[model samples]
Target: MQKLTNTIFLLFFVAIGQGQALPNLDSLLKLVPAAKEDSGKVLLYINIGQQYESNHPEIAKQYYREAGALSRKINYPAGIIKYINNYTFVLNMQGQFDSSLLLNKQAVEIARETKDSINLGKALFNTGTSYRVRSDFESAIRYYEEGKKVFERHGSEETQAIANDILQLLYYSLEQFDKAIEYGTAAVTYLRKVQNLPFLATAASNLGISYARKHEYEKAKALFNETYNIGLKIHDLNAQGSSMLNLGDIALQQSRYSELEKYFSKAEKIFLELDAKESLVISYRGLAIYYLFQRNYPVAAKYGEQGLAITNELNLAFEKRKTLETLSSIYIAMQDIEKGEEYLRMSTRVGDSLLSETIQKNTIEIEKKFEAEKKETQIKALTANQKVQQLSIERKNFLNKILLAAGAAVVIISLLAYRNYKQKQKIQEQRIAELETEKKLAATEAVLKGEEQERTRLAKDLHDGLGGMLSGIKYSFSTMKGNLIMTPENARAFERSMDMLDSSIAEMRRVAHNMMPEALVKFGLDTALKDFCNDINQSGALKVTYQSIGLENLSIDQTTAITIYRISQELLNNIMKHAAAKTAIVQLSHSEDTISLTVEDDGKGFDISILNGARGIGWTNIQTRVEYLKGKTDIQSAPQKGTSIHIELKTS
Candidate 1:
């Protein structure tokens, strides 16, 4: 089974309450002609747009555009923000991620400039939705966390609940079931309190999925039943169909095969009537899996093929992969080994393509985030400069007024005042400089955090998704090896092929580990560093001597630990790639509030002054991270002599 299709629609219901009747579109249109070109008219346009949003989005877009133009003409920031929020939401629903993201970012800028916290929070959440739809989970989580904080502080209970709902789904996507349940429970409780049937059903369904993931089957079932009943009350076909599909999944997990056909059949019928191809795909796949378990290959194959057809038509790579796997199982059960293997290969190819796409998208998003931060920092600096100039002008005007009011007696006083003003202005300029540095550091921190999140995501995808597929393929090949009767030459060739497969698996594991070492997360920084050094030593690329002090029983935050680990990792990688190092020493120590790291390598080195001119990404990244920690870096290297680098940071 798949996630509920009603999840996206929850945003719409949250924005426009389902409890109240929608405004009459014709009445709203008639009112538009007589409405003044003011904020009230902007709101009227929005209301009319909302009336058309569900059934006629293109018409809704037109109205929203008119509202936005009017709001701009009136110089109404709130109206403009609202217009962007509503307009981009429709864009997001239409799969125009680029346009939605651009408009949402604009809304954020406008809201920030106006100091409108409520609208700012809403814009942030909407921007996160755009990233989430594009499968940029790292960026999505970052924005979601920011929006959650804003809503908690300034937004209403309903808005806070909506934020929690979005976070729950995001965590669920990350496979962080515990976090998902935490947010989901909060959202469901508030949604139920308000008796918002549409949102409640969706929230409860999501909460149920989290419970189901945690193997709390009873809780999941109860939630699913609640959602189903809510759907019946609201007469929401999408909710009903989704709930039925979820229940079928739960039944399959619990080995209650008898219930599968009933739930799946009902879901299929409802989805077909509603013309929801995505939900229908899940329904078909569920029936296929049910029949596959029943040993009825023909029936299973039929449903699986139906799902595959829809997935292909929709160009849904993820769903297509699942359907292909189901069909492969059906064919294999029917003793059609050739077709089974062919389908299996196709599934693997699709999975690989998805994995590749994910990596490419993450890379692009990281660059985009960095550039966005840079632009924001520049804007802030310019704004600060403008404020300073304005303050100077106001001060000068006041001084001129004092001079004009008095005679020569005011000349001496004016000189003294001007001297004091100059001093204060200097201080203010220094303060602005400090603020600019802080902003730059903040931007660097965001980029580093984004990079780490991307690495973790890629590591998980590689280790869990592709790793399992490769392992299964190896197992299948091994099984076939025993069943085949081959000549000695063919057997030797098979052995070589097996060896190559083993190498590939090992290489993949190595790459995954390097991306994000499990040791770094499970053990403390000291142990993770030690393990990394040991791995390098075993590889024989460099002999790394690791030393630690005052870190045995010390506790460090995850962010700090990750930063330290990456610094060491990058230093070592640079050593191997550029230093031609035979051996290196990595020393880490913590005393009181300060931590120090020293790396010395016995290899050919270049002039350290070269870093002053231009540097590679690795060197730039190291400098950025060190600056982000508010630390100091000292490097000593020249000609063929070895290089030594030391960094120190205050943990407190």
Candidate 2:
């Protein structure tokens, strides 16, 4: 989980020649000679650099160096910053963290001198990412936050989102899941708003892993599925394979053996097809876990060995460490005590080495931070002394006038003090009101979380405990039916009892599903709502006509989507019980910035004015949820007519 998995993000920013085929070196060289302007040559060089970035970092580095030299010769600050950042990107990818950080800092200084906010943000982000790769989370967060503020001020939504996404990953690694979820959710919304498909997919993947770490498996699986589908659409095989491995991990955790096998196998095949050895390491690890779970020691060992071999060949110390741990467990389970001890020792040695490396990086980061703070403090002290000297000079000049203005100043000061007191009073009142509102919102959130947790616990209890017992009872009844010979009347009684038992089992499943629908967990809001409407329609109690636009393709945050679903469910329940509606229409509209829900019924209605006076818990719950979401809601009703409820929520 400490691994950043930021290759997709790097590719998104560096793959400038992604859509078009890369020109040959000969053609690029010909164009370079034909370019009359140094800027044009620099652009060509950068383009060539991007073409070589993924496959040939050394070549890309040289191209970027050439571009930087040309930009410096032309005195193009923006161009200099650009090429330097590009060069730093290649160094960053090559694990040259110290060199990358130095170059990025140089780019930042140049951008600051030129007042290039965009490039400054880019440089800060790259520097932060390098720190993140080195396990210097505090430094990474500091730079990322600074970059985020710069992008926000410049209205660079895509870059701002990328910064936030990286921050989320950092928070996740730091085990601050709540903060991670907050930023992760924000990043996804911002990226989707900008329609940045590749970054959005990566954000979703990172968010899913965060949720998985927090044991939110259902939400995690949904996000992994989303990333997988997005990767398919974008033709990103690495993203696809990574998401497949995540899905397999979720299935493995849930004990869904068949699904686990399917996902792992698919992931392995994709990695093999693409020859993605790094990703293949993860696939092999998943396969090892799968086989270990099945108690197939031999196959687990094989997969574990494969993972180790690849990690060792590629010099992936982290992956090698993980593979060693897995092999240790496998050998221990196989009762090969001597081999197990050897693997355990090897794992310990690798773990210690990684820990020491992290400690060294952290020490360097702390020293850097200390030096920066020291410089800032020294500058501040100098500024303060200068200010004091200036004040002394001003005092000398104003001494003659001070006596004359003192009386007038006293009166003015009195008035100003009164005004300030009044302002403070008003501010205090406003703050009090805000605090009250926040307290209520906090209480509401707590209640909602508690309800969901209870629902999860109850669903699990019903499904695994009571449901299993009932299934056992049913099986016992079948055996009894096969073994017992009875009169027709006795047999009829026995059959009726069996029928009742079956009904109970079905009822239990229905209750559990209602508590926490698997459809909602697995398929998301769109499918869950449609299935809900279908169930109502099939019952012939109230005819439900459901319609949706743009929801199928939408990637809504799971928590938000579930809140909308619950609101819809409550609305339909109200229509069924209170409105006496025979038919209802539920419409969902999804857009870039807003999600709107409409529920209309064709039954006898009441005055909308009475809604506020209504003593129904259902309306209270709906209002609380809508307020919690910071959404707008409207209810319209008339006697002998129909009722309509409309809700609109801002997506971000």
lDDT of 2 by residue, 14-130 (tens): 211122335676788778767866787888898788666644667878988988998989988888887877787666545567887787788879978988888888888877877
Q: Which run of 10 residues does model 2 get worst, by summed lDDT? A: 10-19
Question: Candidate 1: lDDT of 326?
Answer: 68
Report clash pairs, candidate 2.
none
Candidate 1: misplaced stretches above 4 Å? 1-16, 19-180, 187-199, 212-222, 225-236, 244-269, 282-443, 522-524, 537-545, 552-555, 576-584, 601-617, 636-644
Best by TM-score: 1
Give the alpha-carbon lDDT of every model: 0.80, 0.75
TM-score of each: 0.63, 0.50
Candidate 1 per-residue C-alpha lDDT over 1-652 given as tens digits, one digit per residue, 9 for 90 to 100: 2333333233232231223345667888899889999999999988888666644668889999999999999999999888888888667545567888888889889989999999989988888877776667778878888988888898888787777877887887777889989998998999888887767887898888889888899999899899989878766666677789888888877779778899999999987876667667888988987886676879989999999999899898888887887687678667687998899899889978987886676567656765786687668767866886687678667767877777674677667766876786688678767766866676677667767877886787677555754664566567668888999999999999889988888999999998889898888799999999999999999999999999978999988999999999999999999999899999999999999999999999888878897658898888888888989998999878999999999899
Error of 1 at 249 (Å): 6.3
User: Pairing residues by index, what is the TM-score of model 1?
Assistant: 0.63
Q: List, in order, the clash count of every candidate structure.
A: 0, 0
True-vs-predicted CA distance for residue 251, candidate 1, Å: 8.3
